[model samples]
Target: MKNRVEILAPAGSYEVFLAVMNAGADAVYLAGNMFGARAYAGNLNNEELIKAIEYCKFHNKKMYLTVNTLLKNNEINNELYDYLLPLYNSGLDGVIVQDYGVMKFIHESFPDMEIHASTQMTITDSGYADFLRKYNVTRIVPARELGLEEIRDIHDRTGMEIECFVHGALCYCYSGLCLMSSFIGGRSGNRGRCAQTCRLDFNYNGRESKILSLKDLCTLDILPEIIEAGVFSLKIEGRMKSAEYAAGVTSIYRKYVDMYLNKGKETYKVDKKDRNRLLMLFDRGGQTDGYYMRHNGREMIADNTKISKDLGEKKQYEEYIHRTFVEANPKIKINGIVTIKKNNPVTMSLSFGNIAITIDGPTCETALNRAVSREDVDKQLRKMGQTMFELDTLDIRMEDNIFIPLKSLNELRRTAVDRLTDAYLEASKRNNSHRFLPCAAHKESRNKGISVHVLTYEQADEAVKHNIQRMVIDTEVMSGDEISRCVELCRKNNVKSYIGLPRVDRGTYNVKSNSDGYMIRNMSQKTKCDKEVIADYCIYAFNNYAVSALEDYGITGITYPLELNEKELSEMDIDNGELVVYGRIPLMITANCIDKTSGNCHKGSTLFSMLRDRKNALLPVLTCCKFCYNIIYNSVPVYLFDKLDRIRIQPEYYGIIFTTENATEVADVFKCFNNRTKPEDNTFTRGHFTRGVE
Candidate 1:
């Protein structure tokens, strides 16, 4: 049989785990008390973990543990390794991870353990997913930013086992690459303990918050398409949820997948009753299909409710009680009466076995019998003090008579509390690691690297002064005086600037020129040609004409607009120059800003996002805190620091830019870049546009 869409469910508690398993989940993912991203859930402890594992195994179900948090340098040392050793030994199927350091550590130290790349890694394309193959990752959870075609393409091209989130909350930023949550709060998403401050009702500039709250992703109708795409797993997001929710959602998805596979596409309809049942269970901001279909943002729905808030109140009560009694235990029979003697007047006879324990008033106390344990017996008698009393064992107690107070028993309650506290504390200790590894720095830039679309003269001067080897001038930004000043600056500072010369108007560079005498005769097609030619022209303009344009303007090295692979540059004539290394990859080109995409800006409609994955995360759009545009498919910012040698496609200008709300980190980037020498080019100079003595 073909690989069916495997239904993956989340289990935050032992009961939820059982519910999902019984509801027919193919596999269930859960987190322990600590190092789990959801800090607010009734997570399992180590003992419970063992039980969960054994139960799943006994039932022929698979259980995946979540280690999907970003780690700091100190967090990855002997302590973490020690904790992980047992988990690895416990026959865990795989671990979901995001950070490269974590990936490298797992790859080298525990090659036997299966590593599934977390969606936080933001793997958007097949190329990116292919990059993880070297690490022998068993599967990849692609970024949610990808469209259906993109997902299918990545699945087909890489042939790696792919998992996608079919339901649950959607993040505003790309998974794994987000830093908003970490930036705003000390709790790191990568460490599996995220303080979802994102969901708060934060207001900015008197408007509703836009950083943490986001619509949930729901893809009930697209099961067949997802199955057709050959994704290995369909994951549901809700580690912290009720058993009812787990059963309802899991059963619904399970029923639908079976229907589609058995009877073919369009053979089944999701029962309306099941849909309503799901709605009553839990939902945040309603639901959305997200970016699977198109780039539009309005597809998300919002149906905010008090379900989570109500459930939270219940959780607090559970924590204090230490035990959840679904129903009162109807065992352990005892009936007794006590007599109280005092100087004043108090005597009482009580029979707890048959009474509800309430009396109209306190009367003279009588005892059922002389207490075997006097201290325990007196404790009950003291309340009825100061009068004569008679005592008896019971009014009519039989040997097998059953008795239990509707009220709680102190001895039983105390025992349960101690048990719970022990469990919670031990689990806490097992997961807590106070430190992380020392922060590692990225590789050094060869020369000052490339700058593009600079908005000011100071930006130009800084690039030139720093040896920013190449600069790219957007066609609209290029001016005669500006170009002249830039050319002069490059000469003085030993830098190079590439100006965007309009290809349509320029001779051989512009594809649209019909004039044979003009340089356009050498071009393959006009400006409005096919996309392949457009791409080709963009590449060629950066590699050839842009360089000449810079040289003509008294500059030497020019930069390019498009990020290119070595193969693309090799096909075209290009000189050595730096390309954008570390930073967010710009995805969609837009004429308007994202403010217009803000939906329902009323008091209750503000949206925020969190790096819902296990890592540095933030709501990207409204907050712009750690927003990455290319998150539609999970992927990280471009990291070309690894391959500085083969980069060539220089446009009229080129530069490397690092943007962060934190200034110290930004400054640190320049310092770190200056310290390391490139393996490809030892002769390269730092902070320089071009290598030379002015």
Candidate 2:
């Protein structure tokens, strides 16, 4: 039979790491002191990481470091290598990465290292997975929303190892695409500080509820289907959880995974008591199967059961888990031989697996009182104490009149054990120097192409009058017939057409328009497109390599990230980069509607509503009742109209997003950009285009 599936667990802290290992995890993922998505977690420093790597290797378990957040240009150029070198040298099993720039840097600098595409990449189809294979990415933690059929399709086509989240907290918005945290306050989730505004109270009409709060995902019952679909690793989400949570959850999943692999599928079942424990660990209302079945369903949302309080006496076992894990024997047992002579130094030779270590004790002294006995040698050598090694066999030879001090023997035992530990660790190092074939270069059309992303036809009409080459419209805004008319009108004028898909694509948009392409928010939407796919800015293509990778995945054009400044963007040398010259930044996207929270669940309302944060900045909320999600745009538009002259050099196209702007306001925005007029303060913003996030 094939090897059983991996039971992957989260390690928030060192205690959690030990607990998870003790509970039986094949692998555990933890963030280090830098570039981790779980910034608030007690991420290990370089020293702690060394210990972690050694611990995993000693136990024959895989340890993947999380370098999963988006990094700015300065951070990439200045700090990435320094942060990674020691870990790489220490034999880190793999690195989970989100930023394309970071991945490219690691791939180029450390070719032998195993790279995993983070779930933040939102990989949805085989086309994208196969494309990422160029970077030698060994595995992909696909978006949490992908279904069984989609996962199987990706596996059959790409053959890249797929890791799916079997159990954990769920994000209401698609990961990476969410900017709600960034714009609302300045805490960017991509940088690992999500305020979790989604968990806040939002209402539908008169009823107040935690609409954006999603139930935790528990897929125990669906393990067989998941395994059959070719998921190489079953991941558990919750790096911000407790040690007891880690031990309990991991143990439960470990048991099921083993039972299913050992017995038949017919005998597989989730114990009732275990299920309740899982619920108590953490869940909203209760657990859902996640989007494994489908997307945009009411069953996935939670209106109550906000906090998961306690686990009765089971919580007390957390101490036991930590104590047991730290005390477990090394997976690789060592055998040793000791020799003592009258004058020469006593010699000890230790062997572990195929490797051997030898150390000499202090010069043997003649014991005038008592010669070193066989029992004395045995006692000293076998005193392994708290070390990770266990002396499977200890053989000693002493010459007549030999006198070796017990202290010298103990010192020899410690030295031999230390040397053997290093020898054991050396086996983990690999020379995975992967070779990459050169990719051909390409160019973008530097046509000063001004494509207006409009949510309304009034803005569309104004955009057509301007030098707009393309008019990207939200398909949710108009009916199929009306959108077709708008597409026809844009064609009647000289503009090309593209439909703007939502960040988390739940269903195919009913766009009967004769469109030229799609401006896709995430990779999952790429599968539904028949024409050109424009990788949206939310895809976070900050580096040339990332843009190239997306292009290889069938994306024809790209929108560079808003997080990059003008200097950073210009250096990227993107083949078909679309600079966001203008638009209000979308602060956050949520499944919770503010209008509903404000006691106005006006489902049919297209009117713009606003949510005032503590700072009194009005955040515009657009209800997408059809998709069961909402778009929360920032209070002010990012006006680079003043920098059009400075931005004239790079990117094939310069685009503007038109949200909530009337026909009059649209013309003013175009005029401002066309003539390089600097819009006044309080009316416009220069979001992150000048100052990047840390």
Candidate 3:
């Protein structure tokens, strides 16, 4: 038989784990008490996780641990090994990783454990998938923006396993690249403490709407197509969701996956009853098919889902819980033998999975009353209730007239079961003992030149004319002949050019292979171009290990993560690293367009508006309507011109990003950066360069 696709579910707690497994998930992803992207979830502890693993193993399912949060240098150095060691030994099937440092450490130390690239990595294409293959990443969870064709192409070209999100809540910003919550409220999403700022209401052009909220994804009708595209795993995203939601979603997906597997493509059909149950379970706005079909369309927006918000739906969820979690769990049957003798010890031996445990109870005495009947012995032995095991068979070779206390039998059974449980846990154990090897340091940077990032050809022309010498053009803004002209203008002015890829490119990539190089804003870009790649900060080379790991992929240069402060930067080699010294840093690169929600769609024109938050700060919303994405920029651009003195180490270049700025503003910003001075007006922030993220 052909291998069936995996239906992966999320588990926030042990109860949810059981619900998911019983609902028919082939594998479940969960986080321990720490180091998971869903930090708010009621995650598992070490002991509970171990038990969860063993339970899955016993039930013929798999459990993948989520270590998919970015770690600080201190956390990696102090807490990584201790937190993961026991779980690794307890036979964790796989680990979903977001941090490159975490990936390298785990892969080198364990070597055999499977590493899955988490969606937080924002992987979008085959090249990015291939880049991770050397690090022993067995699977890639591509950014949700990728279409079916893109997913199939990634799998076919890379020959690596592809996993996609088929259903559940969708993030407004592309995963791994969001920093809005951190910038606004000092809670970092990359560190797993997202405040979900996207779900809140914002005023845009006098319209109050949840501008950043996207409808939950539902792909029930397209399961066969997704499977046909060679997606090995279909994942549901809800680690922070409730157990009822877990059971309901898992049960529906499981039923369909089995139906497809058993009935084949010709007979595969999406049942209407299953669809209605899913709709009743939960939805945001309504449901969108997501970016799987086309690039940017209004259909994907989840502006209003008030129907699912009704409290009456709570009863539906409870019914699902009752039907799934309230059902009886499967039991393990063991053939037990009990022996009783006169004036000697009575021993009971139990066997299970290559391990056997024998318990000796109080010695039997000569019968003072009627001899213990067979029915009495059977009834006592069959009380293996509420445990994983049941009394499938019980053999009694009792000494004639030997009397045994009823309490002793109960004690013998309980002891044997407890010992068997431990034996089973040991049988599923794995071992990891290797230590991490550190990378050698590089020389410090000697030069710090200025590079301008422009969003349009006009800006690119002006940038090169001003002898900026280096220009990064946003590809979403420049396309076809305009893109070619930007490159031509840069080359004519003896200015090196780099194509700034969209942070979330899901459609067919139209990158020119002839550019000098590609500024890789996301991992999925490398598969689009074979050019020598420059790593953008969104790729997150946060630690020395992450830098060394990416360097192995032949990446030419790196941009240190913007989250790091001066003290943290001083400790690492910044020779090849570039710093963003000036820019209205993009707070959000999101799919749910604030423009669409601001009722700007009826205008049928592009929108450039401001989202005024509760603080009364107006953040610029840059809409790439064609691409179906919106970038909400910080009200205060990140300007560290004066803070340059605090930076103990230097990088090859300092980058200034221009999103909404005109030619005059761009020139003024560059001049201030060049002179090592602040903007004339006090309209900028020293973002995370002096104070790092939490």
Give the Cα lDDT of each candidate: 0.48, 0.77, 0.80
The better candidate by TM-score, 1 or 2, is 2
- The Cα error of candidate 1 at residue 680, in Å, is 42
Clashes of each: 91, 5, 3
Q: Give lDDT for model 2.
A: 0.77
* lDDT, candidate 1, 105-198, per-residue tens: 6666666667887776556566454346656888888877667787787778778888999887776555544433443444445445455644
Model 2 lDDT tens row, 106-159: 888788788999988877666565446667999988878788888888788888
What range of 10 consecutive residues in model 2 has the weakest lDDT sum? 432-441
| Candidate 3 wrong stretches, greater than 4 Å | 1-3, 265-273, 303-305, 308-313, 316-320, 323-330, 341-347, 353-376, 405-407, 443-445, 457-469, 479-496, 505-516, 527-531, 591-616, 623-630
lDDT winner:
3
lDDT of 3 by residue, 621-652 (tens): 77776566778889888888877776676887
- Model 1 lDDT, full chain set: 0.48
Rank order (by TM-score, best first): 3, 2, 1
Per-residue lDDT for 241 in model 1?
Answer: 72
